[model samples]
Target: MAIYHFEAKMISRGTGRSVVAAAAYASCSKIYNDYDGMMHDYTRKHGCVYSEIFLPSNAPPEWQDRTELWNAVEAAEKAKDSRLARELIVALPVEIGLDEWKAILKDFISKQCVNKGMCADVSIHDTDGHNPHAHILLTMRPIDDKGKWQAKTQKEYLCKRGDEERGFTAAEFKTAQADGWEKQYQYKVDKKKLYMTPTEAEQQGYERVSKNPKSTRYGRQNPICAEWNSEEQVLRWRKAWEGVTNKALEQNSIDARVDCRSFKECGIDEQPTIHEGVSAHIIEQRGGVSERCEMNRQIKADNALLLEIKKQIKKLSAIVVDKVKKTVLDFANTLENLRNRYIFNRYEITQNENISTELKQYNTTIDVTVQRYNGIVQQLDNKITELKKMKAEQKHLNPIHIFRHKELTEHIDKTEKEIKKLQNLKSAFLDKMSCKSEKDIPQY
Candidate 1:
């Protein structure tokens, strides 16, 4: 089965990573970093089946070269802790052969990344062929219409206008400068540092000291770049990839479908498994299964059991909630038809005995139905009891069967609620029947 996996990360200088090196490692090639005089060589690394670079319309045509593109990205950011690039690691459907991987990935990346104006370098790896996946290296900054790297953040200064202090970018401040807006600076006042405008400092008998103006933390991120960095955008990208991959899987006549959401988000009650990363993959590739793989297998087995339990509950719901309820309502309507005829004084004395006989028959039928529903409830109760007993015995064991016990508890609670709903619905039908007891008003 093809599983869903999409992870977003940054190639950041703060983490001591260079985008140029990341590009080389992902593409399985040799590239030299112009920023730090380091050569990243992954020429002999295994399992890179394909690599390609995609560029936007406004981007330089020469940026199609992976090394040149990333080196330019490194050169653009002049900070020690700069975020170099955005990277997405996504799993490809293994059922699709290597021959068709490129077209699917090209459509996916072009729609999700490159069209958003980020230069994307895509690389697919399938060393063991079963774990086929791709690494998407994307530039952080956007290229302008002139093919130059746009500023990730423009300088914004804090300006004072009357009692209001607001921030303006370099371009906005140009016009804002004529509107009684003065830049604020740190002023020395009675051995304390105070931030005020030059006029305010003079009026307060203070001296301006600091030449550097205050700015917002993280400055002002480029709108496009900031949108790309948002959680919603990442989620959108994941969903987009899932849609594309599932389409390919369907085209190949594969039986499996993938979802991008977590188990909880997908409304699944099963616990999710842990990610078995590089070391585990290496072990499995060498024909030795790792402990994590064993754990995942166990998890899959537990999930299958939980799904079976859910299916049984769904069947019960279909019977009690839909079929049984609808039949009861139909019976109620039929009883109401007779009552309506009697209510409007349309029944003659000759028909009174016949109507009474019919009412008695309806009472007997309702009783039988109520009894049948009671039986169903009893059966559900018995199942819950068995589950609880199993849960208790498992809890007493050394390992305690943690997952099963928890699911069983939830199952028990859900069943009890369903039983409550069944009881209430039965009472509602009995309320409309009007002669629920045999001892009182039975021969009416």
Candidate 2:
């Protein structure tokens, strides 16, 4: 089966990471970081199926080279704790060939990252021939139309209106100040000095730029919110990958699809088996005992038991439906016959000279009808009891069984409805018999 696994992390300087080192490890090649003047080499590293760099349309064409691309990233980022790159690790479908995998990944990166101005360094790995996956290193900063990297943040000046501060451009700030509205500055060097212009302060060796206190610390060009770093975005990216991979699989006519949902979200009640990587798989294949192998064995057993329970519930549902149909038919026939026999006896008493024999026959017919109704009612009760027992048993099994065998629930509902109808009919018959006896009694 094609499994879903997409993970994301950052190659950050705060965590002691370099984009060049990350690129070297993922692509299994050598690269040099010009910022630190350090060389990172993994040229002897193995198991890299494919490695390439994808850039935006406006980016420099020379950035197609991995060394040049990542070296530029290192050179652009000057802070010691700068976030150099964003990395995504995704599991590729092993059922697809290498070419298909490459096509799918290329389309995904082109649409998702490159179009959004992030250069993607994609590397496919197939170590041990079983775990095929891809690593994508993405740039965090936006690129300009001139193919130059833009600062992640830019400064904006704010102006104070009537008791409220509002953001303004440099020209708007100059106009507002000239319009005689009080302006606020974040850095006030001297309390006694009323105000000093930025140029005067700079000329006097005060190298600080006074900012509006209400102005934002930094403004970002990209519209994406900072909340994109949250778990919700991770789930969204995973789902997106699942959709892309499934589409590719469908295009290739593969019967399998991947889901980024959890077992519960997928409406499955079974415990998911743990992922045993290539090493564990090989060890288990060699008849070795491992925790993952044992867990898998138990999961298989539980699944088998769940299947058996489903079969039993289905069989029981069929039996109950069949029995109810037959019983209702028989009871309806008996009630019709009893009603006809009573009407005949009443006519015989009104027209014939001897009424005792007719009366006796009527009584016998009524008794037989009552006995048949009782027998059918008992059988129905027994069927319901058995069904209830089955339902109770199902409660001990997986909750997934309820979702899998919806017909079983429907049958139970139908049986209960039939029981209610029969009981109502029985009551009506008894009421008719009582009314007839009251009218047949001789006057005192």
Candidate 3:
């Protein structure tokens, strides 16, 4: 799922140093590298001082036009005049494949500016985690002098003056000014609320900017704390609570995914804890697959291997049988040639009645050669017969044959034991599918 996770800070023109400007610079240097030729488009489509141009209602137009948002933020030394500089922070989803993140920022500014009754001046870009973010620069002074805002502080007026008059060097002054702003407009925290506390609301899981502890029953100041009385109890508590947090996080994530609300509005107070729990559960579910799926995958892989083996066996058997046939044929031809030579030599011996001693010796040599040829031809016949038997046995020795063979008997037995596990998974899925009402289904 796509998410926008970002934080915005108000910078002072007097100080010249700005967190918002730094964030912008970082986005330019890092984020711009991803989409080729998108930087120029980003500048044109979404004005450079994004928040001021699109979310016009977020900040007063006169405030940014006179102050020059970029110039004020670019200067590092000028301290921010909280009295004259206001910023609104917001995060919203901009899917990865959607229009460049800057475009989404423009649309969001248009909607939120009108809703909040402020002028729009926004800056938005994707973050390191691929989450998009927006920064809004707002006018500290009210549009109408007698509106909700009454008057501006002298310090704010001085910072608004030209560069020569605005010297940003006073850390102590800035701190005191920030502190005064909080005292006048601090957030109100109600203790009896069962939902989240003020501390939770301020966290918002943005950058670590907001900090104000709320009063709770388990506040740090409590004299005595609750703990398990014994080690055994602690172990029991750990086991019992282990799955509870995971269940809550999973349910919360599902709600957050479907609901159009911020993290705070979604009832998530401890972001880190919830994030960890949900991640762990997802990993666990994936690692431990259903027995039915596992068996199915294994069976498919084995069947493919068996098919390959059978093809190889068929090719090899053809080659062996052909070689034996050729060998037998060659021996038979040699035997025939030997018999013809023997008959010719016998006819010559019979025609010469008064044979010489040398001729008699030649006759004996011919006789022995013929006998050797007969013996070799008989051996070839026997080898051919053996090859034919082996060819017949090949079909019986196929993979199915081997799988059921005595050698693999033990393995087959174990596989049968595992079949029940897959059956159980199928049964459970069927039962779940059959449930017609919520009451019929099991609860956590």
Candidate 4:
């Protein structure tokens, strides 16, 4: 099985539209989002499973930089974009079983996509079948008519903290954050059930959420650590996230590979020729030639069989004729013998003065011989007539009599022409898919 992995990013300003288009063209990959910002995220490679789906540009038209994006998101809380702030999530079904994987993603973001001003575009990759995945870039800010932002899942964001240097001592840390005051961070069995508001912590007589398991007895960290900028942490988080996602998929009996990448995993650098678009066009021509070659192979076998059958039929006909000829000769011998016996019987009858027993016996024998000879002649004639008819039919059906080897030769010629045409077509497709420059990478 090939790896069921996909890479994606939130489009940023730096994503050049031309580059994105070029990538799509070279990889035969699909393009989902046309917005400038979303394109940026893809080229910069800020996408992965954890941050799989990304937010669209929330920055003002003139605004630039991540800070502007944050500001735009903030302003959208009060007043949203008039034009539906469109964001999309694109994916390729290559490794993840395009059909089911896309379905899962659609269901996961169904509510998000259906919301006013929000839309999701899901399409199959029609390229060389290298990275058959999806590209999803959704909006971070809400639309004007959707009402004020209620900030769903925003609470999860607030629980995070700065790096370890900014981290306060155990006592001070508990006092610093609201959850710390509630002892949510403390390692205690029952403390997990307790809730702590920032002000409530000071009034309730709880100290900083103790990190020591002996104190609060609940040692739990926030799910999304506040720091995503650290490269090492990001790598570990990505690995863990992928492992968990893959494990879950396995548990549910879902596949973990894509068809496109399987060939590469098996060391097939060449892409399948039956793909859609230009690649398909090229292969069709080439395949036509290959098909003709295979057809010609069958033609050769058929011709050979026909020739062999004709030869066997001829040999059988000759044997039948020889047997009929011998029957004719036997009929002649019987007729001559009967004539001679009849003559002898007549003489004996003439010479007999008393009862001619010998003559009578001879006469009876001659009659039987004549009758038997007649029957043999009739049967031979019937067989000869039948053999002649069979020979005529065989000649009519035989290739040598009808079209002969010429017909088969003509067929081969026509097929060869067709094969030539297909070869030309294959060549055309290859030219189209060929890499033109150093950056225009070829995808199998």
The numbered model that scores best in lDDT is: 1
Task: Please provide the root mean square deviation of candidate 1 (C-alpha atoms, Å).
Answer: 24.9
lDDT of 1 by residue, 167-190 (tens): 999888889999989888999988
Ranking by lDDT: 1, 2, 4, 3
Q: 1-444, model 4: which lDDT tens digit per residue?
A: 434343334433333223234333332344433433443233333223222222223313332233243334434433222222222323333444544554556553453343323323333343355545444433433433333332321212113233211323354555666644222233223455343333444665566555432232223232222222224543443344345445446655777623323456667533333213334345457653233233343445444544554564455456656587775565456556655655665454445523445655765765565454445445545555554555555556656555554554555555555545554544444344463432443322
> What's the best-to-worst order under TM-score?
1, 2, 3, 4
TM-score of each: 0.65, 0.56, 0.25, 0.23
Q: Which candidate gets the maximum TM-score versus the true structure?
A: 1
Better of 1 and 4 by lDDT: 1
lDDT of each candidate versus the true structure: 0.81, 0.74, 0.39, 0.41
What TM-score does prediction 3 earn? 0.25
Q: Residue-wise lDDT of candidate 3 within 319-433, one digit each (tens)? A: 6664867755654565566556556654655444345455558656655644444454455455455545544455466666764454445544444444444445434443544
Candidate 4: Cα lDDT at 188:
22
- Of 1 and 3, which scores higher on lDDT? 1
For all candidates, what are the clash counts? Answer: 0, 0, 25, 36
